[model samples]
Target chain A: MSVLQIFRKTIMAVVCKPIAHFWFGLNLLHKERLPENGPAIIIANHNSHLDTFLLLTLFKTNLLHRLKPVAAADYFLKGGFSSWVSLRLIGILPVTRERKRGESDPLQACYRALERGDILIIFPEGSRGAPEEMSNFKTGIARIARQFPEVPVIPIYLQNAGRALPKGKRVPVPFVFTAIIGEALTYPGDRAEFMEQIRSAMAALKEEAPQLKWPEQES
Target chain B: MSFPFSLPSNTSLTAIVLIYGLLGLASLIYLFQKQRGGGSDELAARLGSWWVIITLMIVPLMLGALPFLLIMSFISFVALKEFLSITPGRMEDRPIVVAAYLTIPLQAFFIWLHAYGIFLILVPVYAFLVLAYLMTTYGKVERFLPSIGIFHWALMTTVYNLGYVSYIMFLPGGCNGTAGNAAIVLFLLIATQLNDVAQYVWGKSFGKRKILPSVSPNKTWEGFIGGWATTALFIAIVGPMMTPMQFPESLLFAALMPLVGFIGDVTMSAIKRDLGVKDTSSLIPGHGGALDRLDSLTFTAPLFFHLLVFTSYGPFAMSCS
Candidate 1:
């Protein structure tokens, strides 16, 4: 493992696990549905920076290196300490959100990362809104899904993470988060249909959040 | 080996055996029900958890005061963490959250030192002023009063109240010749916990009228009366044997402790009702979160300690430190 990988592992083990699981309380469901190997895309609803930490901590320590988050280039890749943390520590596959005029595609980094068999974490909502409140899903994830038809699209509904660490908040208040990982989705039809499918899938996850049965009883 | 506070080793050993024996009886009931093809998974799970809980309580107690202190503080940590996570927080008052987490160990440290003077007032006096001031420093006026109120309240219930349970070790023990300090802790724990069980049993069997319909529908007057009588009787019988109290004082402690535990339970329910979530978190499989389990204890511990101090510790000066 590389030095940065070791540092990331340490953070996941020491800091992130306690803050994300114990302190913030990540009650993960359907975690077994997550593919052990990648060439996979983990799409989630955007809410808080805590979403990234919570998701990153889900993978095994050795597999931590292969887990890469697909974030906005304009925001995350802007040079300095944040860029360093995002690019190196989190290992985000930075994609320029704006339409750029060039022969090269904006999602080139994501495509390259996927081709290399690295699991990409994508937020279809593009940006965060109010806590636990979600907006319309962007088509960027659908395109990624269509391009890599074999790659599994895991829809994770992170409930209450927005309350933990929402946008513009540097310090995170302790709030329990529930990350509901849905079953793996493959590109079913065209881009728009796939987009609609995942969107409704997330909505289904949200509905199931309250009624979902947990085997937490003593018996 | 001698304990920091005098709990006669033999007395505590007997307490351990009795606790284990109770656990064994529970297991046997579970087994019998299984044989009759009427075993519930919930009962099995509850028994499994009780086995662990009983063992955890007894072993640390045998080890000495420090282990018990560690267990109590850990519980406070989990309970506080659950409280903070469940409640909605303002972004501007984020620093105060960190301060809240910091208070757990600091309070525990005071207990380790047996610095009753500082331990008694640290959260009430210092944490109150400092946390409020910390919120003001952020200079965000939106919901300042409510945020401060919530922060201080969280600290009080989770850290301050539970800290009293650990402080019981330092209570000047008048019964040190026969009973150990462990007996006092066990007495409070048993009375409070059994009161909950007794109340649930009574409520299910004969509960007719509701106490606080909107707040906690399950709590009925019958359950309340039955639980009080049962807990008070048990305390009166056991307190004289284990604690430094006569029958009447034991009865008094019994009457108040169970009542206070009920308050704690309902208060937590009110918080849950507002938050729109059930069972703080699933830390314990059978029993909600640590906070859920400790809710009554949080209320009972402080009252139990103060009652002991008022009756036994204050006049005794030094019993067996």
Candidate 2:
């Protein structure tokens, strides 16, 4: 394994997995559904900075080397320590959220990574939001899925991550979080239809465990 | 510094050997059953994991007090992390969470220093008050009662109660005769864990009538009584060898230890039931979380600690001077 891959594995093993298991009480369901081989797209509803770590924790150790997260360049690759962490430690593929005057296509980075047989994690919602509340997905994932029709797009719904670390919080509170991985989807050939399918699939997962519903939805 | 290869006395050695012999025989029977295609893969996996756990536990213990204390602290840290992870806490409670994590090391440090006075009050008295004040600084009363309660209870059960195991090493040698402090700690672990196994086995074999159907449906009266009797007998036979307690006190210790350990297990089950999760986390393959593995220890450690201390120093031992 490469040094960066080794570093990522060590961080996940020593730091992320333990913290996720111990501090956040992370439970992963239907992880067996995750394909054991080949490239795939993992799309999830982002709730906290923890969403990335929580999702990564679900995969077995050896599979981690094949996993590359697509992160927002504006936030993660602004240069300096954050850029180092994004490029070196996590090995994230930084996709520029905002297109600059003469900059290359952001999707090109993601497309090439997927073509190279890397399993990519993408939060189609674009950024973090409140728990149980989902934003409309950006079409970047749909566009990428269209380009790589052979790669499966797996949808994951993360519950309670917002309460664990939420946006704007440096430290996370311990809250039991669950990651529900839905069946992988082949791109339906229509971007809007694909996005809807992904969204509905995530919504359908919320019904899997009634107890995991948001407190407001209980009564 | 010279390390002792053997336990302080022949009694302790005999007790260890007997325990290992029983485990070896159980593994042999399990292997035989597997050959006949009558054994479960789950049981086989559990036995395999138990070998690793036993080695991890016994080796450090053999190294003496500091290693044992460090291991116990690491367990507490993991257990507390599992406890907090499963329970819901708000983002506003971040400071309190940090404080909770910070308390683990300090608590272990106090036990390491043998500052019994400070160690005793560190979590119950000081960490409680400090964390409560820290929560107030957040100025959020949305989950005031529950938030504070979760933080306090997590510390008490995970950090403070489990810390008592390490403190077992600090118990005055006079309390345990020449069997040594390691013997007492090992005795508690053996009785508590064996009680769990006996209860499960007896429950499967002849259990009828639920003890607490709502909380833990699998727990049955037959298992409870059978386990209690067996564990109590086992302790009575082996206890004197490990602890300074004579027959009557050994009998009392054995009886109470299992009962308390049962309560601890059931209490954790109730919490899991309320939270709608099976185990705390799946850190251990067949065992569930660190909390699952250490549940019985949480209750037995503190109760046994006080019982041994009081028995040794009499009623005035509360001062622990």
Specify the highest-TM-score model's number: 2
lDDT of 1 by residue, A20-105 (tens): 66566755566678779877899888888878888888877777888998888888877999999898888887877788576577
Model 2 lDDT per residue over B1-321, tens place: 665644446555666677778789989999999898898877877787787787777777777778888888878777877777667666567667778989989988888777888989999999999999888885888868888988898999999998888888766655666677788888888999999999998999999889999999999999998998899898888887787677778877877988998999999888878767777766666786778888888899899888777665544343333
How would you class the docking of model 1?
incorrect
Q: Model 1: how many Å of interface RMSD?
A: 6.5
Per-residue lDDT of candidate 2, residues A1-219 (tens digit): 778778778888899888777666755667678878659999988888888888788888778877888998788977899789878777788877888788887689888888788899999888887665788888888889999888999998887778767788776666667777899899988988988898789888865532531245354
Model 1 per-residue lDDT tens digits across residues B1-321: 855644446666777788789889989988998999988887887778878777777667666678888887877777777776666567555567789888988998988877888897899999999998888885899767767888888899999998887877656544444576777788788888898888988999999999999999899999988998898888888887777777778778877878898999999999887666677776666776778888898899888877777776654323432
Maximum-lDDT candidate? 2
**CA lDDT, every prediction?**
0.79, 0.81
lDDT, model 1: 0.79
iRMS of each prediction in angstroms? 6.5, 4.0
TM-score of each: 0.79, 0.86
How high is the lDDT of residue B219 in model 1? 91
